[model samples]
Target chain A: MSGPTVLLTDAAPAKAASTRRSALLGGGGRALLGLLLPLLLAGAWEIAVASGFATGRLLPPPSRIGAALWSLAASGELWTHVAATLIRVGLGFAFGAGAGILFGALTATLPPLRWLLDPSLQALRAVPSLAWVPLFILWFGILETPKVALIAVGVFFPVYVGVAGAIASVDRKLVEVGRIFRLSPLALARRILLPAVLPATLTALRTGLGLGFLFVVAAELMGASEGLGYLLVDGQQFSKPDQILAAIISFAVVGKLADTALVTLTSPLVRWQDTARETL
Target chain B: MLSLQSLSKTYADGTRALEAIDLAVPNAEIVALIGGSGCGKTTLLRLVAGLDRPSAGRIALDGEPITGPHPGVGLVFQEPRLLPWLDVAANVGFGVSDLPRRERAERVAHALERVGLAEHAGRWPRELSGGQQQRVSIARAFVANPRVLLLDEPFSALDAFTRKDLHRHLLALWEEVRPTVLIVTHDVSEAVALADRAIVMRPKPGRLDESVALPLRRPRDPAAPASEAATRTILGALDRSLRPRDAARTPELAGGSSF
Candidate 1:
């Protein structure tokens, strides 16, 4: 038994390495193929335009989009709109995340409070953020309030649902362990439940940030003079697709930045996730 | 320092898991609760751990009846059940936060060292192998320096080699701390190997069937040939309990060799 076991053990590692090498090669090949796809599509689009199968106004070339990006950067107009959009989204996210997490925790812990608050909140959540734009204009009269409110509404639900679900999903065994350790209810919640749920809440925060960016653009499109969304509208009316494409590229860039920042903010809490995924 | 007076449990679904059971575990003694599937061994362990309430009985630790989980009681479940978000050291220090920070760090380090996992302190639950994870669970239980440690089939999921290694390590740890231990297990060999006194339990409205004092001495070598005789003896008793007619008729049997 020992001899055969020794033989198998010695052979297994080599077999495992070869298999892993082949799997990695296959995965890398697929990744290279995926990277080439967007360039292929852009090249095809340019060819179609050259062949007169599509008009330049209908489908702008990648080169034109690049030129628009350079022009916007040179004029400093992109920076102005980007800064305005960032401030609004930041304020909306901070307010919405704070309020939503507080109410979500209360609702999750107290059944009576949940019964009173959840249905109304669910109804509020059902109304699209854009639908609230007109209502907010009626209330706050179309300044920054409507835009911020729209983004805030977009931001709230994800964080609220995330916090509540995280709290509810805490392991009963860990709670029991806390009880055995004689931890107070507050202590248990702080030490065990809070830490356990933080990863989910942070993930929700990242997702909410992305949603806020999307809605910031949408809200500006509906009515605003100072944001990337407004830039898109201005570009469309003036027939400057370059400016439109430039605003869109800037939006994508900002969205990526916000995502990266949120991930950085929550990195410490999710360090375990990083290490676990590292092995694979 | 633990006593159960007429401890019985009936599930909400009307199945009686345990019925009118009386048990006492003296301080620092390791008692193994052994039985087949659905025999209420886990129920007994849970009741003692205060994870569940008895349907119609009382459990007391050192005289006072327990209404809820008592402090200084550590429990290790079948699965490691380590919180996925925590590293090995954090998982071990999970319940010991009341101590000073320096002392907590020392205790966490010591516990991990005791389990031979000091090198793996920064690893997450997913990073470690199953046996290593279970060892971390054991370290978590022991880190509290609990007065009463209850293990419910803790090694059941492990392979035979890892299970044996853990049994030896557990006994070594028990000798050091000497908490009142009550282990629940279905494997007769495991019960016989680790226990000082093995209590056989009957299934379906479960009750204590027989209690046998292990003939093998403390710090017995699990790999030694001398241990096999004692193993056979315990297995023989377990075999008798498995026989349908005799188990139903007698309900309690001792000092009989069925094999």
Candidate 2:
């Protein structure tokens, strides 16, 4: 027995050391590769505008958008709109994701609750999220309350779906392992259910956050406001194509940045995952 | 002692998985269960583990009945069933979570070292090979100091060499704690090498067919003549179990033999 064990230890660490991928095309390299095509397209659009190939009207080029953004930054106008949108999204996400996990866990563990809630929730899912806008404005008085509520509603469904689905799909075999250990229900949930559901839950949160941005546009559209959505409306009312393009570009960049930040923060939670994401 | 009294199981769909089975496994004895598919060997193991209900009979550990999983009993499945989110040490420590921190850590460390996994404690389960993962599960089972261990083909997925290696490791661990063990396996040599007796079963409504005692001494070599003879005897019993006529006719013949 000792002989075999000794042989195994000797062989395993060597294999582990060799499994490391070459450093040349690592994580940084892949990120840079992802940025390549978008940078090329943006450069091409900028040049097309600069060399007099197009009027650069109605469709402002990258340089004009950048200038618009730069002026907004210098005059401190961009900060106010950006701050409002971020706060609404942050608050809505906290509320929505929190309730999602709570109810998701409840419905998953209790069949009675699932039978009672799942059908109505699914029906509610079909109602266009924006359909709540007019009613919400009338109800909440065209304030931050309505906007945040709308964003929270947008963020809720996916997270709820994710939590319930993740819990339902957790491997029964692993649960048996918990049972064999005589784990208490609370300990079983903490030790097994929580970790098992984490990966999918984080994914759902990303989906919810993305929807938060989408609903923020609808929310700001409901009434007078300071936000990126307000910039979209403002640019259109004033007929400033440059500002509209700038706001649109800001939406894309800010959304991507927020998603990136989320993935970075939660990556450590699922670091034990043996998926392709870790390898590439 | 771990005992089953007239254990029987019938599923909801009108299938009799096990019927009228009686068994008594004394303390510190290792019993290997061998049978064809649907023989209810795994079903019997599950009953004893308290993971399922026995329709006709009850399982007892010592003098008390087992209604649910007990801290005194530990089970290992065909797959590792490890908590992939946890590292090796944490997985081993999971069963003893109620213990004092110092005692739990000490037991986990000792079990890991016993199973040749002390060096791999910090590593995630995904980083391990199939054999190593099984070893970690074995360590997890022992960490709680279980009095009876149930193994459901724990090494069935490994290669021949790895399986043989694991048999040795498992025996070594068994020798230390001497827990009453019930192992379900298709491998005849495994029965000869590890079990004190091999219980063969008949299928459909699975019942104990023959009990072949392997009186061979500890650290039995698979290639030795005594071990080969024991293996052949268990294989013969397994072969006879496939036919109803052969089994019903020879009720008392294989029950008394030892190699």
RMSD in angstroms between candidate 1 and the native structure over all alpha carbons: 5.4
lDDT of each: 0.83, 0.89
For model 1, residues A1-280, the per-residue Cα lDDT tens digits are 8999999999999999998878876877668778798989989888887788888794587778888888777888778889999999998898889887998899988999999999999888887778887788899887898888888889999889888888888788877767766788899888778887887788788878988998898888887888898889998999988778878888888999888877777787767664542232
lDDT winner: 2
lDDT per residue as tens, model 2, A1-280: 8999999999998877665544535777778889999899889888988888977888888788889999998999998989998999999999988988898999999999999998998898899989988888889989899999999999999999999999999999999999998888998999998999999999999999999999988888776569998999998999999998888888888899998999889999999997755442
Instruction: Name the regions of candidate 2 deviating beyond 4 angstroms.
Output: A1-41, A44-48, A277-280, B246-250, B253-255
Model 1, B29-82: lDDT tens per residue? 788888889989888888887878889999888898887777767899888988
Q: Which residue pairs overlap in candidate 2's backbone?
A: none
Worst 10 residues of 1 chain B by lDDT: B250-259
Window of ten residues with lowest summed lDDT in model 2 chain A: A16-25
Docking level for model 1: acceptable
Question: lDDT of candidate 1?
Answer: 0.83
